[model samples]
Target: MSLANKPNRKLIATLAALLFAGSAAAFNLDSNVPITVNADNARLDDGKGIATYTGDVVMTQGETELTADRVVLYRDETGLQRIEASGQPAHYRQAATEGQGKTDAKALNITYSAPESLLTFEKEAVIEQNGNLFRGDIIHYDSVQRVVTAEGAANDNNGSGRVEMVIQPRSRQNTQDPDGSSQGQ
Candidate 1:
C-alpha cells in the first residue's frame, strides 16, 4: 500500500491510534529479563554501573532489539534505570507477544526507561505497526499506561508544521481466524 506523507485530519487521528495501540500489552517486557548489548567500543564505570557503547551498537532482551550508533546504559545501586541511544536514526523492533506482527521504530534519539517501560523518540521520529506509519518531530510512548503522544517540531519555519501519518486498511487475512472458524461467511 502507498503511504500518505501529507498532513491531514485523518493523519492526526491515525497517529493517535498508532501511538497508543502500538504500546498495547502484546509485548509486556519484564524488568527481571536480562539485557545483552554488543558494540565496537564499550566503557564502563564500575563505581556508577554506567556503561557507554559506541559504533554499531546492538542491544537485545528476549524478543526486543535495539540498534544504534551509540548506546548508554544507566544503572544505579538499585538496578538498571534507563537506556539512551543515538544514531542517524536509532532503530527498535519487538516481536508481537499475542499475534503475528511486530512494532518497528526509528529516531535520531531514542530513550527507554526500564522501570516505567516508556520510550521517547526525538528528532525525525517514525513508528510503524502492521502497515500504518506515524511520523513527527517527537513521539513519546508510555507502555504502562498504553498512551502515545506525537507532535511536530516548533521551528520558525513558514509551514503548517503538522504531524504526518498513514493508515492502511486491515487485510482480510488479519480479520480472519487462524482456525478457519467462520460463523456466517
Candidate 2:
C-alpha cells in the first residue's frame, strides 16, 4: 500500500495469470499530492468556498490527470473537500510505476471526495491498466483503503448493465532461478 515501496516484479509479471474480480482501483503513486485544475471559465464564491469551471476543464494531481467538460470544486477551511466532474465521457489517467504502462479511465461523471478519499465513477465507467480493461455501470474506488467496487446499473428492465473485464496475457520474459542463476546463462 505504501507508494514508496517498489511494486512486486513477480506480481506484475504474473498479473495476467491472476484472475481479477474487477474490483481493484488503478495503482497510482501520486494520490497524496496536491491537485490543480484549470479551465477557460471559472466562477468562484469565496464565501462558500466553491468554484465552478466550464469549457474544457483539466485537472492534475501529480502524475494523474483528468479532463472533462465541466468541473466543480468544493472546499472548506481545511482546504479542498470534494470535486465533481461531468462530460459526455470524462477522462482520467495516471502513471503505473517505472516499467508498467499507464492506467486510463473513462466515465460520464466522476466525483472525488477528499475527506473519504473516495472516487466514484457513474454511467458507463471503464478503466484500462497494463493492457487489461474493466467496465461497469458504476465504479467506486477508495484510495485510502485501496478498495474498489464495480456495480451494475439498475433500470426498470432487468439486467441492464453488467460488469465486464478483459485481461491480457502476460508476455514471456527471461526469469532468474531461485538460486540466482540466469536462465539465459
Candidate 3:
C-alpha cells in the first residue's frame, strides 16, 4: 500500500511528532507541517501493522530532518507504537527556538516509543545543542518528563569509556552604562 494513502496519514503524523518531540519546547509548528519521506524502497504490511523503509531513508518535517539507512514503523490497532532507524550513523536535526541554534544528534541506532514517550540513541550517540555537546554509548530522552540520561560503554576497561560533555561559554555583549556609554567596550 502507498504510504501517502489516507489510512497511513495518522502514521505519518505520529512519526512526525515522535521525531520532533525530543525537546519539550521544540518548534511548535513543526508537527503541523507535512512529513515527507524519500527512500529507495518501502513495504507496508497491514497484517502486522508494520512499515519498513530501507536504502537511504530520509524523513523531514518543517525544519526537522532524520536520515538513516533503514527505518521501521510499528503500529497497533491503537495507533503508532514505535519507530526505529538504523544506519552507519543515523542523524537527526531540528531547528531550535529563536536565538538558540539547531539541535543535532547522531547514533548507530535511534528508537522512539510512543507509550513511554521516550527517545533512545545507542552506539556512539552524540547530541549537540546550542554549542553544548554530549557524547555517550547510549542516550535516552524522556519527552514527557523532559529528562535526559546517558550511559557510557559497558565493556570498556579503559577510562575512555566515560561519557563526555562540552559546554561553551556565553559571549558578553555590550551593555549601556549608567553614563550612557557602552559598558563592555
RMSD of 3: 13.4
What is the lDDT of every predicted structure here?
0.73, 0.69, 0.70
For candidate 2, the per-residue lDDT at 155 reads 59
Residue-level lDDT of model 2, residues 12-48, one tens digit each, is 3334233222223332323576677889999999999
- In terms of lDDT, which candidate is stronger, 1 or 2? 1
lDDT of 2: 0.69
Q: What is the C-alpha RMSD of each candidate to the true structure, in Å?
A: 7.2, 9.8, 13.4
**lDDT tens string, model 3, 76-104?**
98877788999999997766443354668
Clashing pairs in 2: none
Give residue 52's lDDT in candidate 3 (0 to 100): 95
Q: Which candidate number would show the highest lDDT if scored against the true structure?
A: 1
Per-residue alpha-carbon lDDT of model 1 for 147-181, expressed as tens digits? 66788887658434667777655552255243322
TM-score of each: 0.76, 0.71, 0.73
Q: Sort the predicted structures by lDDT, highest score first.
A: 1, 3, 2
Q: Which stretches of candidate 3 lie over 4 Å from their true place?
A: 1-30, 155-159, 172-185
Number of backbone collisions per candidate: 0, 0, 0
